[model samples]
Target: MLNCLIIDDEPLALQLLEDFVSKTPYLRLAGKFEEPLQALQVLKEQPIDLLFLDIRMPDISGIDFYRSLPYKPEVIFTTAYSEFAINGFELKAMDYLLKPISYEKFLTACNRVNDFLAARQLKEKKEKDYFFINVSHKMHKIFFDDILYLEGYKDYTKVHLSGSPNPLLILHNLKYFEDLLEDKEFIRIHRSYIVSLRKLNTISRKAVSIGNLQLPVSDNYRDGFFALIGEHAK
Candidate 1:
């Protein structure tokens, strides 16, 4: 369900949008305001997912108000003016609703928001679960949590996993994995070793322990490793 907020100066326009939201099953009315200034107080206290906003208002324009906001929710700009449509889209407004908005058009915009959010959530879940890489000739699936450490030998790298007796050897070097896993929880501690920061057990001046393996922390990579682990640079 989407928590919706409406900001319109027109009393009749505000009432119509409220009625439209009431008819929709996915939309829950969080707050409704006749003035843009009145809605500012409610915005601070509420976690609004969607906004039905008026483009032209007495005190402030909706386009200016949205631009000033620190965190903007998905917005559907409601206005009679066709000229402001370009301005609304520039701010990444989800949809532009002209005055005399039909219930059918409102629903079509809501469905777009729902579909976009659903796809984003699915993508985030898959990213957290696994990352695939070339293992021999086939693309191998490896869970992020299963990783212990990676060891590089010349042009090849071996990925060590928890509960596994032998590591999976890949054609890629440690430098290749280091660049690929830059945003992942893995960090390079030595020239030959890249360990998962999540699977770390203990750390000392010159070494880090993941599972039973004691990987050396080279001087070149020591400062970066410690900084990433939230420790003062050694």
Candidate 2:
């Protein structure tokens, strides 16, 4: 089942989307929020597969809010204005749904999401130590052992390698890489970093060292990271 969230300022719109999610067998409603910021923690802590985002809002536009997210999910933009469709598609949104959405349109979007996720899960389940990343519009194979660390810069991540002098930059968030590398030989040491377990040269209470490079371990991820490395931070 695809877990979903709805963010709309209008009570009626929220209720409408909530009803649609409830009626769909494959879609589960994770939460609904009037303020986009209210859902930030939920987004971090829970697994959300899809989001129904309202385009216009008081403080933050839906487009901006989606861009700001560290963890991005498949999104369907719902708006009263047709002009916002291009912006939504530019951000790689699954669908652009106009306001006053009928059940038919909603179901169509849900069907597309289901199909896309089906393919993605299949791709992920493949047994391999290396995964392919899109680089310059082409799929580039990256092996887990070659990775030294990962650096995050907003929506972009830098894949540092053992032999390569320069890191490979990809259009993916740190959180995305964290999830992608889950159950693998990787541990997130900071909001902006993830390091290979086999590549870590040294570990301290507030930082880790790899290949002569030092990466700070933030307070948030300190304990979990230490435990993973089998160290007791003082």
Question: What does the lDDT come to for candidate 1?
Answer: 0.89
User: Which residue runs does candidate 1 get wrong by more than 4 Å?
Assistant: 129-144, 147-234
Where does model 2 exceed 4 Å of error?
A: 127-234
Q: Which 10 consecutive positions of candidate 1 have the poorest summed lDDT?
A: 225-234
**Tens-digit per-residue lDDT, 60-144, candidate 1:** 9999999888889999999999999999999999999998899999999999988887788667755776878888789999987
Let me know the TM-score candidate 2 reaches against the reference structure. Answer: 0.55
Candidate 1 residue 203 Cα shift, in angstroms, is 37
Most accurate candidate by TM-score = 1
TM-score between candidate 1 and the true structure: 0.57
lDDT of residue 189 for candidate 1: 92
Lowest lDDT 10-residue stretch of candidate 2: 225-234
